[model samples]
Target: MAEEIKVIVFGLAHEEYGIEVDKVRTIERMMPITRVPKTLAFIKGVINLRGVVLPVIDLRGRFGLPESDATDSSRIIIVAVNDLEVGFIVDSANDVIDINTDSIELPPEVVGGIKAKYLRGVAKIGGSRLLIMLNLSEVLNKNEIIQLEEQEV
Candidate 1:
């Protein structure tokens, strides 16, 4: 009733982003991925996590940002999408915060050149910090999700 919800904060391309915490499964350090041929450019490969094989996408690549070599802070954020779980690589994830829902504003046509469909909203935090909220479903759009499922078949 505080008009607030918790989010898992992460970074991609030096910009901040957030996702509803409930959708996140886990966060892991960068790991080895097996290349899957003929897939989308953003789909780096697949990672065998524990006993589950999950597709991993580089958020930067998906967002059409310049690729950078992985650093110590690189991370994989596993998130549940529809009936499958996928992993997304980010620069890092270090914060869990409660952001007031009322503070969120409709996303502009573009943010740093990222497509508007990929965004859920934009929120101002701490009077100066801006956080980009992502619509996971849109980020992994229906077409992409379908392709991923087909690859599994």
Candidate 2:
């Protein structure tokens, strides 16, 4: 039997992306975010969730995708990486599936306009569907992490 990993799949710009279930904390519906000054463009500021303030990142902006207004289907995915817990605003998060690790392949230079440096790998699911796995560490790189820390409120 092949090693299977559970993935929390979400939509971004009409494409599918997954994050290992272990890295995800929770997924919530779109909520109000208070903007902070001088932070990164993609950093959509912070959100107050159940008494805890979490910095939020707009994944579309983070991936350099076209900006679009949030809709009813928008969601906020909270993930913890490198001792930092942050929220990522995604188009929608509606699937959780188990995938065979063997099905994953090295990422090409670019996938869906996102650079390969921010990806872990690309997985082929059901032989036709592709899932882009994000390297959270690289997505929340050390330098950016420092900046986020400084903006803590």
Candidate 3:
């Protein structure tokens, strides 16, 4: 796939990451998320988005990173994976970038301090711009999603 692919870029900590743009449904600013008890720490909670409840996962917590205070730039990236829509809390939801497949290289066990297993690849753009491509399947495949789907709240 040497053709250009669109990706939605976001920030977490001091690094940048990207997800397939087609998978993204929308981006919303920080919003109230009702916490769910007895759930994983990464599963922050769920939010009622336009009459539809979406499970929200804290990306930092999911990646085992230290939590940073949520800022105004913080956003919830709504994406559809496995026919289920969920929200991923990120430091910020930036722009949509076009990356040529040739610029992407296999993740080297670790990228931007996050495990490679959670990444699909790394894109080197413009010589110094590194965009870590996230593996949505791996990031959202935890059994918690199943639990969240069963939950009404």
Candidate 4:
């Protein structure tokens, strides 16, 4: 039997979420962000990752949560979305969990304000806590992301 694919999961506003570990390039702490005007409210700003500039999105803001200050636990999950490299700021980065295909289940019709189409599935880790598996492509599409980038310009 083939081994299960492990995903690096994180939390945002008390909700659990995960992404394929392979897509994640690296994780970094909160850095100085050059604020860009007229961009979406969810977008914090762009960050200089080494030599490359990557847009950083606040997951809490995107999910319509109350604004909170970044703490030591705050982290940016650098991921490649539709060939565009972007970073997502989350409350905290959790452990890398191994979840087999069998353990994954499709999300319900409604998940807060998030549509089910954006979710890959839901993984029940322990007893009551559920981890939402995210489809990066759906979550961050090329066309829409480009529009957001254009607004920054």
If ranked by lDDT, best first, what sequence of candidates would result?
Answer: 2, 1, 3, 4
**Lowest lDDT block of 10, candidate 2:** 144-153
Cα lDDT listed for each candidate = 0.91, 0.93, 0.89, 0.84
Tell me how far the alpha carbon of residue 18 in candidate 2 is from the true structure, in angstroms, after superposition. Answer: 0.3
Q: List where candidate 3 sits over 4 angstroms from the true fold.
A: 143-153
lDDT (0-100) at residue 130 of candidate 3?
93
Residue 105 in candidate 3, Cα distance off native in Å? 0.4
How do all models score by TM-score? 0.92, 0.92, 0.91, 0.87
Candidate 1 on 1-153: residue-level lDDT in tens?
A: 448989999999989999999999999999999999877777899999999999999999889898888889999999996876989999999799999998899999999889888999998898999999999988878686577658756
- Compared with the true structure, model 1 gives a TM-score of 0.92
RMSD (Cα, Å) of candidate 3?
3.6
**Model 2 misplacement above 4 A:** 144-153
Q: Which scores greater on TM-score, model 1 or model 4? A: 1
RMSD of each: 3.1, 3.1, 3.6, 2.6
Q: Top TM-score: which candidate number?
A: 2
Cα miss at 135, model 3 (Å)?
A: 0.5
The top-ranked prediction according to lDDT is 2
Off by over 4 Å in 1: 144-153
Q: Write the per-residue lDDT of candidate 2 for residues 33-116, one digit (tens) a residue.
A: 999997777889999999999999999988889988999999999999999899999999979999999999999999989999
| Candidate 3 local lDDT, 11-99, one digit each (tens) | 99889999999999999998999998977777899999999999999999889899987899999999998887999999998899899
* Model with the higher lDDT, candidate 1 or 3: 1
Q: Rank the candidates by TM-score, best first.
A: 2, 1, 3, 4
